[model samples]
Target: MASRKSGKPASAKPAQPTAPKYLDAKRGVANWTQATEWLRVRGIEDIECITPDFAGVARGKMMPSSKFTSNTSLSLPSAVFRHTISGEYPEETGDFRYDPLDGDLKLVPDLSTLSVVPWETDPTAQVICDMVTTKGEPVSYTPRNVLKKVVELYTARGWKPVVAPEIEFYLVAQHEDPDYPLKPPRGRSGRTITGGQSYSIAGVNEFDELVDDIYDFSDKQGLEIDTLIHEEGPAQLEINLRHGDPVELADQVFMFKRTIREAALKHGMYATFMAKPMQQYAGSAMHIHQSVVDAKSGKNVFSKADGEPSEAFFHFIGGMQHYVPRALVMMAPYVNSYRRLTPDMACPVNNAWGYDNRTTAFRVPHSEPVARRVENRLPSSDANSYLALAASLACGYLGMVNGLVPSDPAYKTVNEGSVDLPRGLLEALSLLEGEPAFAEMFGQEFINTYVGVKRGEFETFMQVISPWEREFLLLNV
Candidate 1:
């Protein structure tokens, strides 16, 4: 695809964007009154009343600003939660059966998530909604709701968990056909990027205009980006988000994916969050750096007063090492996701933990005690942000509460083809189904539906005959 040139003059300076005023207005809008006033002041014309589905796809309705009020009620079919990535309902949904007469679920707006849709031509605002029953009970299976439930577990224990996500993605040429492989887009130098450009400034500068748009869009939405760097894959870039509350960060990530894709389309390219978009390049990952703190004292629970590693820290690691494989289905949700977990692809092959080791699934980075945290390198970039964060935190919570002990730190590289994780989606789903802990932490109904959705996707994949099958088996067999 050809890149579209912007009409702005080369010497012109871009205007400095300001954060949304509602953010500083008593931390955020607390009620519909405050939310209405904020929208009114912005001269908003349309409101996107939306919620993230299981695939992190924004699903909801758009209403005129005048019709949007504090009392506005929006509903979607409960079947939306049971939808596979292909938008089809699974034939079998485990113990949680889908009702023949699809029911409606209410969408309750979260006022804090209200932000301007900068990419839209019309004055539009979007807000993330939480799904609830007509009786006002939360929909436990919804991804955002699942994360909130896990966070509440920490809150009940007087502990607050914080997470920062480093998400990697690739910019590829626009291709209309699904059968063809993706190719890197042409940059400013009129050349396609080659692999092995990690941390290269010139590599980043090649797509300066698109990168600037990403930053501008993020600023308008109040998404704070800690840093952006080139990764080891061709045209692959990683954006690190500032750490904060789990739910808040997850919301930002869900929104950020939309923002990034829109910005890329504006430049005539496609930004793919696929775990392994290219066959011969590095796979993308969403590496999560997480830690816990005392809710009252605001002290780091992973570190003691003397700046030494706390028992809770080790337990958290132990929990991740023990339970991440069971929860792998949540992090690597798609069949293609497992292709990214192979050794020597800049991906972790085992659940081993070590100090600043990239080969291990869990790594304790070098930091002062206050910033001490464990980095989980298992999740693929294609995962649902809310579910990934919830699964990770739940595992750590189980470790801390159960006083689990981790194996000794891995002193040597653990990625030498010693695969410790399930090799396929079905295998991972089987592991998840056998683990009662996940069902206990995240409701059993959710577990059933999630497993069912994944199984349906895997079955659909099996129906397809790949080029490889025809290339060899067609003649040889």
Candidate 2:
């Protein structure tokens, strides 16, 4: 995969002295007063009030810092959640109807999420907001609220779920035409990457200047990146986030996507989170490593006093194996997402659980008793972070509560001819709608709306003619 000539690297900006103080204040800003003080101290000129829609796209308003007070009201149409990726709403969404008046939902900012927008030319801040109804009730169908609902379930049971997400994405050259395929961007060497460079330090150094900006931006935003490494595709990289609360981690992932894209653009490159951006190369994925802990004791529930795997561990796996097939639509939302699940692409096609085996959908990584956890490898980078984490945890929660049993761990390769998962977007949506358990956990209304949105996207995708059909089916069929 060759690319066009690289653009001149942008000069790094000087770090602000207030950046460290802003990062420290993010942890202690619990109310509007403290939030206002933090912004005032940082000399914030603008504030971005944003929330993640069903597609994980940032949707909300931007305002001058002086006008963004505690009493300031922000809203968006409820219909934003119903819109598909192609900006089209399905005319007929079964069992779910759009309000004729198109009601508005209030945006209540989560003050803890406030951080500096490091890449912005001016002193700007951003905060993630939660949507609520006119009556001050939470909108249960919203992605963030859905995740919060699941987290509350764990809280009710005196358990806390921890997650560490490893997000993989590709760096491609800037392209204008949608008809042309993406190619790896040229690095400092002024040469295009030709093949896979897994874990190659030299390969990573090719784009060291860009990576430095990513690190600097993340630091200013108070996002912690545990590690960064090259993956098995040309110009592909992965960043692992430190394990913490599910909702907090999801918020970080949501912000990190925008931060990465902004950082890439500064270097005249495009950072793509598409599941399968190029053919004949490994696809991007968002692998979630999760574990449950006792809320009071702060101990891993997956391990027993004897340092052996507990029943809860196996039950969690069992829950995933049973429900992930049905929850595929949440983890793999886009039509292009399915292209990454092929057997040859080093992606899991089945929900087989195993010990440190990448071929299985759920792998129990080798860790000390305190860190015993299961890694769910199904979610694509294109998935909504909030929904994907919610679905995964919900499944595990059901497993623990219902005492589900898992099959014996797979000792050999289980990637080949494993057709246990849905093969297409339509199939995945059907499976999701047919499963009542998900509807109960994620809410029936949310399920209906999600299925409707996905159906609309799939229908739109079907209307387009691909090159394969023009080449092979134009005359042969």
Candidate 3:
């Protein structure tokens, strides 16, 4: 049976990487015509076709409206988001499959999903779309479609997942030498430095000017940015955004990355959300905070009096703990991502939960009802926000239905024991492959296709040699 956790005998600490502006609760009118008017008024020349990338990001360039995008819907190659240009889904009879060799797919905006891109000239606006064929059903396995399906699941149950994101990244000088590899940051004069002061404002003086633009731009875009904080890596910063429904929250994350990257470029610097950019620094993560709310009453399903989450919260936490191993492949998509979960990287290496504990993979923050929720602290900033969120909802649903019960968390790091993430991408793939239960959970077709793409990616990575290789093996060989 699940039981309420007792307070640990320690001083209460504010949640790390805290950003309050993100927590300000408000909603916007999603009228497409209104947005279009906003764009036209700004003299936007043309909308380049808006299409979803393989990574679920909206990508395309723009021209004059008279020249392009004036047709309302543009054609894209369906092979774009598919794992390979070959367009195979695990190969029929173990052989690969390809699509209609012709690159003739359509991109029709949802209109309601349009949001202004702050940095773009002529004020180009982007709207996400649902990929379809001659018939109009959402694509069965598009990652965004997968997230939409999960959102429907919650809606059916009269519940919705409220979500917020905490994204961490590093700002660095662009490298000219591909042979040298990007060297990690050192605390140069006026450079941001890393210490464990997760939320100390003084730590942010290095980017005194840059952080201001991030704040101002987010404000103009009506982004629910809470605050930006100095993280535990020299030159790394974590920006927190306010919580909202799952899909919108993920959308905010997508936009948030764009904002930061654009702002960094304007200042002539580079920003990386790479999971483990440096072995010595804390790896970047796009941590998600979530809770369930009743659709009818608009009340928190996880809430108890004083904003404390209910017993259901424990079950949800338990479900996540159980599913971490199987879900790691999706959360940590890249082969190098596993490297970030090692000791001292800030991400928990294992499936575990704790109350008000930063060391645990899941943290229960010290907040009352509106703020009472669990923090999923594993995924790298490079994660496709939609897919990771779907994975999270699936796990939370598993916890709720199976009645998962969490146990006391380990306050300290566990390195020698099993309290760690899978050692390698291959191992994570095995966890996914070995689990028929999870395949059934996510649907076999989806699982099969996704695994095929990930495994293919690993095979591709294995073919490349690294600078670290020449350093150790050149003279030795």
Candidate 4:
């Protein structure tokens, strides 16, 4: 399965580092022509030029293959960058970026991301695009570009970062009512999960059909899924992707979520990446395993020659501890996201590091020198992969460049002595705004827009009354 992910279209891989003339608009239209021919041979008639928004939702335009091949550029409203999670425009804020007068932004398709839509009957290909102004500057808030900037920072230092993401989600029976609690979907064995079964083979076999189909679709889409394990939650499951380049890994994570959801809908069940879908069960997380390697030698830089830890490794951990609180907005991006970050939720509530200690936010796994890595348990499954990876890598990069030292490992447990992270969305957002390192790393323009948009989401969430409130406070108040 891991080998399948490296099968890229011939166009994606080049002997040289720089993009070829075929991709440049000024050079020639040959690449577009070649791409059109390539799709035509594969029975694809349409192309969707997609860009991930601030909320990590796919947004873009669909065009016929002929138009896509002929057009030199695609135009989408710049306001799409500022749209909130509810699909609402933050017009009330009056920020120039959110104003109604927003105009067009150019969409540059990343030809390398082109993949066939296995779920669509008519044969469509989708490629992720990068948003840029007509003058050619990358849009500050574009999630992919934001990630690319961080990757570039590593490239400049002759280093490469590899990441593997473990994503957890739930399979539930679809319910139409907004107030109703979700129930586990019945498996092919005619039974709904009633007990916690962490790593139970019988538990995984209950939904064997669904699990088989997920693997089938994942392979069809070139996702390099490595392992599947039944989690402690009733119907919750976790999938692990093999470690690879950060940007490529993020793309796979993004596509894998969509594929899982669509496959679930087809089977009359629903899959949610919600951080805390069930009140009684453990929350879901997108735990990331990261390691830095020397670009030239292709060797792990976190380990020394005699198998001792490297200075870079300690600095990386220090950076993560120093910066994770400020990057919480991207790690746990929604109101429900904070619900998963409680003290005993098996979620990391602080920046403490430990050697194989699940209680800490960052854990140094036991591995060979060549495979030494740090596992970040901070991000929820609901996070935008691009932003989350970018923020995580940026923190480690800062630590490496500045030579910061990490605090002593939490050899005991989280209960002994660990600092608590922000307790809620509002608090996390406030922390993000107050952190100077984050503002300087991500830029003020992005910070302001992201805060404004997410603040609106938080405000909108407060307007809705929940069943818990009514049940507990309606008569008492």
What TM-score goes with each of the models? 0.94, 0.94, 0.84, 0.91
Flag regions of model 3 displaced more than 4 Å. 1-36, 48-51, 60-71, 83-96, 100-103, 181-200, 304-309, 411-419, 437-443, 474-477
lDDT of 1 by residue, 56-102 (tens): 99999999987888487899998998878887777865475785788
C-alpha RMSD values across all candidates: 9.4, 10.6, 13.2, 8.5
Cα displacement (Å) at residue 452, model 4:
0.6
Model 3 scores worst on lDDT over the 10 consecutive residues at: 20-29
How much lDDT does each candidate structure score?
0.91, 0.91, 0.69, 0.84
Instruction: Please give the lDDT score for candidate 4.
Output: 0.84
Q: Give the per-residue lDDT digits (tens) of candidate 4, residues 148-260.
A: 88888899999999999999999999889968888998887888886578898988898887888888777766677899999999888999999999988888888889889
- Report the error of model 3 at residue 318, Å: 1.6
User: Residue 265 deviation, candidate 4, in Å?
Assistant: 0.7
Query: In candidate 2, what are the lDDT values of residues 291-387, reduced to their tens digit?
Result: 9999999999999999999999999999999988889889999989999999968899998999999999999999999999999999999999999
What lDDT tens digits, residue by residue, belong to model 3 across residues 1-477? 323464554555567984333222122324544444445555656554454454656655455645443455556665566564234333332222336574555655655455555677655655566666646656656676677777887787788888888889888767776555445343324444555656667767666667778877676656777878888776789988888878777767776788888888887777888888776767898888888888888777788766656888888888888886778777888876877877655667767777777777788787777667888888888788888888878788778878988776656654334646677877887787677656545666566666667767777777779878988999998
Supply candidate 3's per-residue lDDT for 15: 77
Model 2 lDDT at residue 74: 91
